[model samples]
Target: MSVNIDLEITVTGPLDAEQAERIADALNDVAQDEGIQHDISFVVDEWEGRIEVVGGTEYPLIITRFGQWQPTFESRVHGAVQAVALAAKADIKWGYPDDED
Candidate 1:
């Protein structure tokens, strides 16, 4: 095949301050793993920080972000992934069809 494919990954969610920090770290790893050479794109967008309800019911710290990937190089990040130590396990969404649906 003379055509090339663009590999991309995006991350987004609502999480606490700590969780958001961890997620951000994880996203960096993901981006490094995918590699810019492979046209990989990564991004994190923070949406909700705090939500309030009636009776002064304030919600915890909430954050939402997104990561996109597209490798411009070859062979991924070549094992030189930028990972963080002692970080929470981030939930990865692979865009797989909902089997339960």
Candidate 2:
């Protein structure tokens, strides 16, 4: 059976280019370690030095994949994101749909 997981990571910032690359690298590492194939994509907007209320004050980076994954994959991904967030001094919000949903 195949499973498709849709993942989104929202970074609240004023992030510099280097910081953004670090986050992307961390997430990619997770995908590599899991031995899962992923087509990664990102959305970035110029930080205006102020949060915009219209979009909940965050920049979103999204990842999507359809394939088999190990049972511990999600946890590992979360940890990687968290570590990157801490180092980058940015806040992160992420989620994936429940398997049953």
- What are the TM-scores, per candidate, against the unseen true structure? 0.31, 0.44
Residue-level lDDT tens digits of model 1 in 1-101: 12222223333333345544544455455455533222333334444653111010022111122122212221232222223222223222222122224
**Which runs of model 2 end up more than 4 angstroms from their true locations?**
41-71, 87-101
lDDT (tens digit, per residue) of candidate 2 on 59-90: 22233443334335556655665665553333
Candidate 1 root-mean-square deviation in Å: 13.6
lDDT of each: 0.31, 0.45
Error of 1 at 3 (Å): 5.9
Per-prediction count of colliding residue pairs? 25, 0
Model 1, 16: alpha-carbon shift in Å?
0.2
**In candidate 2, what residue range of length 10 has the lowest lDDT sum?**
52-61
